[model samples]
Target: MTVKEVKKGNACALLPLIIFVALFIGAGVLTKDFSNMPLNVAVIIASAVALLMNRKEKFEIKVSIFTKGAGHPNIMLMAIIFILAGAFATVAKGMGAVDSTVNLGLSLLPANLLMVGLFAIGCFISISMGTSMGTVVALAPIGIGIASQTDIPVALTMATVIGGAMFGDNLSMISDTTIAAVRTQHTKMKDKFKVNFFIVLPGAILTAIILGVITRGNKAVIGADFHYELIKILPYIAVLAAALAGVHVLIVLIGGTIFAGGVGLADGSYSFGSFLKTIGEGLMSMEDLAIIALLIGGLVEVIRHNGGIDYLLYTVNSKIKSKKGAEFGIAGLVSAAAIATANNTISIVVTGPLAKSIADEYEIDPRKSASLLDTFAGSWQGILPYGGQMLAAAGLAAISPVSIIPYSFYPILMGGCAILAILNGYPKLGTKSKEVKQVATVPVEE
Candidate 1:
């Protein structure tokens, strides 16, 4: 390619990404309804814009780029997981798992201890499963159900779930963000986990304390009669144990559905036909989100084809002059990519290669860099009201997604602490290895 052609091509990459942000964020603001505009529609418009911007390329080449984006391994893996999760969640709920779980949970705790316990559970489940969405899906309804029984606001309960989920999502070794960051930055997972744990540890503790204090006033103890039979609680426990076992999340969810169905039918809680109905309901419940997922996949493909990612990378790298700036760049890159994509794992994957290159140039510690990428992306994912995790939490709680934004202390603090630690050199990047010379060349934001 000629010099001018290459420059133009690289700059063209950002077009779809711009369109996506404008449409998605814009629609949400203009309509004053988070779901007023379908995510798929916004993605479709942006993708078309991306394709149009790359008109200079051969149609076949353009198609190839789009295909590559859609077929990216990370994207495909997430999609499959979404499908299975949908099926499992629907079946479990239909078969009375959600109700049973909720009633059982409520009956087991004092009202004063409800909020903190819910948050703690959210944290534990997400940490074990390495997924915020999975945790939110499994726990948000329970939180909401608890709220309805008491006088607690559902939105507050929803925020509790979101906060706890983010704590684990940011630090969990099995998280997609962690994998993407580690692979891209060439770091050990255990090392990154250590760096991240310290940064977010205080935030998690503080949030839990705050929630505990807030709920402490309501001290009513739940009665045993309100609890479901112990058998009914098997599905959730099984799912949690399986996730902790490092079983693939898809399998864990499927297993939960089977266990729930078997126990439900055997206990006369549900008929076989109802069990199938429950499964179908769960699968169908995720239909809207599934469409949104596919649209995001296709939209990102167009953005990648049009050079949007490269454009951002080039601009960001040109201005980095120090270790602090490099750290900030890494955080900002992953944060921006995640907000645009609404998927932490994909965000890390998209930003990882470039972040890796930056780390190499700055002689920054690979482990620190990896931790920053994962922590920031996961943090951003938590705060983004439109993101799948928050959306799922909001939907399950029957609350507005934005309602959880201000109160999501864990994610917000994680982002702040990660940036602060980088600036202060708290983790001491040189501890692991000699500093590699920096290679970054992106324009610095003024």
Candidate 2:
């Protein structure tokens, strides 16, 4: 009458991603479409399974764990950004601001260089804004218009925007990933950026060339009579200026919403009542993302509590045999966490404590570790089908998030540079830096 089997607790930690993929298959069967269904529902279902896994634990403990994850500061911050971004975007689109802005951009740039221009613009905006989500919000809609009026694929354009955003977000001094990495590793931000910038420069250049080639043969289909109003394009300009001025993102979006609303009223794009309606509609559009983010936050907490994080660390750290090996270990650990959490900042934060320990053990420079944490996490997150950046871009483009991964050129190249940095130990810290004393050790028998 007694059970003899023991559960593999850590293995169960992967239940969420497993269930999410299964839901895609199930959706394909039920609805004949795998990409556009309710992905948040998959997270919800996985959450339930996570709660039920450890029956020996108190129910209150399980609820508390779920609640803490759902209420994490980072997750809450992202939810708020989503709501504000939606409101700004909706009000702008409802006011014809999007069309006017597109017209201006199309008129100013030639067809052959439009994709390159978008990528370059995305890099500048993301660096200024210090938030890839903010960058994507500002540019993806314009990319959509460019795609519609040209021969380029919507997915490729979306991918280009995201790739550029990641490039800047990884190196921006004000970015959350950069801030988290520097603070966790106790290094100066400027120092980290110097090393980080050099590592990513080659990748950025290569990505630009690739975009230019892919877009060269494409022609603009816009007619000579295409028109736009300069007055209506102020909203995007205002957003970009405020971001460049170092304004906080929350204020940027709130101010953008109000400014866009004022413009809408002045131009009679929408009546006051319809303006309110547009705001409501905008909030509704991002609800799925907010819900999914909360579920993922909670699900990741459950996985960590069940030893999933430790298992990854052990799996990677066990392979270290030298200083260089330790550097790669940090990369692999952070990369794995990014794939699991689908968030770059959270991945760096969760893995930082152990990474610092590894850096100390091997005497690897803090600057290097900080750069590695941000680089590796960013490279992985930029391509994750479930990450916020991909979801936001795809939602704006009316396409599946998975569709953009094939064109994530910058992220793919950034990873290559990171690997090379590890191998070559570029920017080698002088031997004058602290080094651990060699102590004789005894091997333990298994």
Candidate 3:
């Protein structure tokens, strides 16, 4: 493509996203209430801007591109998951599963360590599920209930779930972000995991410590009337176990829904008609989140097609000089892409080639490059209020996404550690292996 045709660093191409931030975040700041402007309305306005900016393309073509993005396999899958998660959550709650599970947890763990325990649970579930969204879907309701029963703010509790979810997203071997990072940088998954584990371990520990300290004074008061039922809690246990066994997340949620429904039926919690109605109610509850995801998908696709992402890459690529610079560039590149796409795996896949090139030029370790890419992408995903992780958690908890940002301690710490790694060359950068160097120019499969 010709230089003019490439449209690198074209500011106008990013206007839609800029407008979105201005409308969503700026409006919140001005109004002093983040929820004053609904997320869907802001997205819709920005999408219209994107469509208007692409005047050169036929209206039909533009609509087709937006539709393609909205209907992307990943986006569609997330939409389906949202519906299933809503059903599972509603049915499980109707069956008294959430309360029973919460009471069981309260009975087992010390009151003061509740937040820490929740964080740990989120970490385990996300690592097992290999998807932060899945982890959030599974645990957010319980987190909500725990927060309501304790002195903890609901936002802080949800943030804990987000922080832990991102921890696994960055480190899990089966995570899409991990797979993309490893393959793009020509590193083995195990090597990348080893490097990633050490780099982020300190952050995780600090987060846990912070959570404990903050929550130490806020002990939960378990009510004498609260009782646990093992049968009611089986759905959650079964879902966690199935996820750990490498079952597909969709199947896990569907199975959980069915299991919870059966429990409700046997217990006479709801008749068959009522059970079906509850499922419908749950699906309807997820309507807002599903619409927002679709809008974001379409909006992001337009930005990408209009050269916004290319411009971001061009700007970041122009500044790299030394190995450390390249490392930071890779981190920044993926972070920016994640901000634009609202999906870490997609960001990694989009920027992996550029990151590989930067690594090769600087002779940086593939493991390090892979780790940086995954770490930064995951970190950004955790912070973006409109991103799926936070959105899913917020939707499930019936809270605003912006409220959860400040308490996302683990993700913030992870980002800090990533910056430190780039500056200090953590894990000790070594000479790039010949095999890695040879494959540096190869295209990676997404």
Residues 293-369 of candidate 3 have per-residue lDDT tens digits of 67777887788788776686567656765678878888877887677567687677656766776677677888888
Per-prediction TM-score, please?
0.71, 0.64, 0.65
Model 3 accuracy (lDDT, Cα): 0.76
Best by lDDT: 3
lDDT of candidates 1 onward, in order: 0.68, 0.75, 0.76
- The reply for model 3, stretches above 4 Å from the true place, is 1-9, 111-202, 210-226, 321-411, 417-446
Clash count in backbone of candidate 1: 21
Worst 10 residues of 3 by lDDT: 437-446
Order the candidates by TM-score, highest first.
1, 3, 2
Ranking by lDDT: 3, 2, 1
Error of 1 at 98 (Å): 3.4
What CA RMSD would candidate 2 show? 9.6
